[model samples]
Target: MMNYERLQSNINAYKKTGEILEAARFLIHQFNLDDENFAGFGFREELEKESILLTANGEIGEMQHVMIPKNIFDFDLTLVLNMLAHEMLHVRQKSPRMMILDKNEREWQAYYEMLFHTNFPQIPELSDYYKNFFGEKALIYYSRMGEGSELQLKYLEQKLEVEKFLQDIKNKTI
Candidate 1:
C-alpha cells in the first residue's frame, strides 16, 4: 500500500515549489515505483528550456535525475508528471545496461507503457501529439501489442488494479 502520510508530507514540503512534485508523487505510487531505487535529485531551476533526461551511466535505472526550469513548473503539472513517469519507465525497463537498443527505441517503450498504464485521461491528447510527430506507426504498435498475446492484457490488468487502488485512496481523501 502507498504511504499516504508520507505522500502528504512530501506534498507539503514541495508546496512552495508547486503542484508538479505532488503529481510526481502520485505517479510514483500509482506505478509502484520504489523511491529508494529512484532518486529525484538536482531539481534546481535552469534558465534554459525545461527538460528531463535519463542518465544510464552510474546507476542503470537505479537513479532518476530530473531538471525543470523555474518558469515552466507551474505551466503544466501533468507534463512534468509525464516526464517523470517516462524516465521512471526507462528505469523499470533496465534500459541503461542494454547497449544494443537505441534511445529512440527505449523512449518508445517508455511512452507506450505510460500511455497504456497511467490513469490520467489526457493520454489521448498526448498520444495524438506523439502520433503526429513520431508517425502513427508507433501508436499503432502500442495499440497492437495485445492482438493475440495474453501478456499485454495481463500487464494492463495489473496496471489497472494499481491505478484503481490509487484512485480509491484519492477518493477517500476527498
Candidate 2:
C-alpha cells in the first residue's frame, strides 16, 4: 500500500526544491514527446543521510524513492534541483533496453539534460569520477560532451533527433 500523504508531502517538497524540472517536462510535452518515452517516470524525496537510487527497469515516476542528506534541504537549492533532474531522467529512461546500452551513454544523457535545462556546471570532479570508475572511453566522451565540442554535441543532437523521429512514428501508428 502507498502512503498518499507522504507522497503528497514529497511532491510539495520537490516543488519547493525547484520548478525547473516541471518547466522542462512542459517543454518536452510542448514539443510532443511520445507518451512511451515517459511512461514510467516519477519522483520522491525523503529525509535521508546520503543516498540516491535509480531503477533502470521501472516505469517512469513509478519508483517512489529518493533519499538525500537531510542537510541537503538547507544547502543550495540548485544542487538539490540538479540532482532531482538527474535522477528523474534516469527514471524516464528506465528499461531493460537501456540497461543493454553503454552505461556512459546513460550517464551522458542525464548529465547533458541536467546541464542543458538547469544552471549546473560540469564539475571537474564528476568527470574525473566517471573516468576513474569507467575508464578512458567514458572520460573522453564525457569531457568532449561537457566541453561543448561540436562533434560530441552533434552526436547527442542526432541521437535525440532519431529518438524523436521514432517516437513520432510510434505515435502515428498508435
Candidate 3:
C-alpha cells in the first residue's frame, strides 16, 4: 500500500499554491474513496490537443496519472469540486474489465452523484440539466444505495438514446 503520510505531506506542500490538489485529497477522504493506484495529483500548464479540463490514464489497480488543466482554476470552486468529484467517481469504477459501465452510463452516474450527493454547490446549469432529464423525484429515487438501481440503469439507457439523437441532430445542423 502507498504511504498516505507521504502523500499528505506532498499535498501539504501544495496548500500554498495548489488549492485544487488539496481539495482533491479532501474529497478523497470525504468520500472514503479508494485511491490505491492513484499516482499523483497536479496541474498542467500545457495540455494535449484533445485533453479535458481534468484527465487521467493508465491501467486499473496500477499507477494512474490524474491532472487538471491549470485554466480550470479560474472557474468557481464549486465547478472545480464538481469536476474533481466526477473524475474521482471514475476511480471508484474499477472492475475486471476496467470499467463496469459504458461511457455514457458512467457519466450519468457520476453526474448524478456529484450533483445530488457531493454536498458541493452545483452549477445551476448542470443541476437544471439533470432535473430536466430525470426530474427531481426520479433523481432522488435513483440516488439511493439499493433502491431503484435497476430502474436507474434502464432510465440511463433511454437517456443516452435521447442524447445520441440530439447529438446527431446537432451535428447535422452544424
Candidate 4:
C-alpha cells in the first residue's frame, strides 16, 4: 500500500532541509536505487542558480548510480519528486542506437508508474507536464541527438495523446 502520511511527512517535515533529505532517501528507495551506491559529499555553496545539476557518464541503457543535489528539495515537493524521477532515470540509459525507442518507452513507463502507481497523490501539480513530460522530452532530446528518425511521427502522436488526456481530465473536473 502507498503511504500518503509518510510521503507527506517526508516532503513536509518541520525542517525543510530534513524534509528534502528524507524525501530523497525515500525516493531512492522507492525506485529501488541504492542509498549508499552514490555519494553526495560536496559542501553547500552559495549557488546562485535555481538548482543544482547531476551528470551520469555511460553508454545508453547501462545502469548507474546518480548523485542528487540536496538543493533540489527546495522546489515544490511534487515538482521536485517528478524531477527526481526524470533525472534519476537519466542515470540509467540505453545505447545510442536504441536511444529513440528506449528513452521514450522507459520514460513513459517510469513516469506513469511513479505517478499513477502512487495513486496520483493529492498534489495538483502531479497532473501536468511538470510531472508527465518524460516521453515528450525524450522525443526532443533524442531527435536532436540524431538525424531525427521516422519515429518523430509516433513521438508526436504520443505527446498529443498525453496532452489530450490531461486536457480531458481537466475538462471533466470542471
Q: What are the per-residue Cα lDDT tens digits for candidate 3 across 1-174? A: 235465445455555476766656664565455366576677766565433467655565455566777555454444555567666666655443356445545555665655355433332224343333433323444445244466566766544544554455456656
Alpha-carbon shift of residue 42 in model 3 (angstroms): 3.8
Best candidate, lDDT-wise?
3
Top model number, TM-score? 4
Please give the RMSD to the true structure for each candidate, in Å.
10.0, 14.4, 10.8, 6.0
- Residue-pair clashes per prediction, in order, are 0, 8, 0, 5
Clashing residue pairs for model 3: none
Better of 1 and 4 by TM-score: 4
The sequence of per-residue lDDT tens digits that candidate 4 reaches over residues 1-174 is: 247567656566634655545566666565454422244222234355565554433455444445556566566665655555544545533433334345545555445434444322432346454433443554454355345465445456655655666566667657
The total number of steric clashes, by the backbone 3 Å criterion, in model 1 comes to: 0
Q: How accurate is candidate 3 locally (lDDT)?
A: 0.53
Kindly list the per-residue Cα lDDT of model 2 for residues 69-132, writing each as its tens digit. Answer: 3344443333444555555556545543344244455566665554344322332123323223
How far in Å is the alpha carbon of 95 misplaced in model 2? 4.2
TM-score for candidate 4, please give it.
Answer: 0.51
Model 1 accuracy (lDDT, Cα):
0.47
A best-first ranking of the candidates according to their lDDT comes to: 3, 4, 1, 2
Task: Choose 3 or 4, whichever is better by lDDT.
Answer: 3
Better of 1 and 3 by TM-score: 3
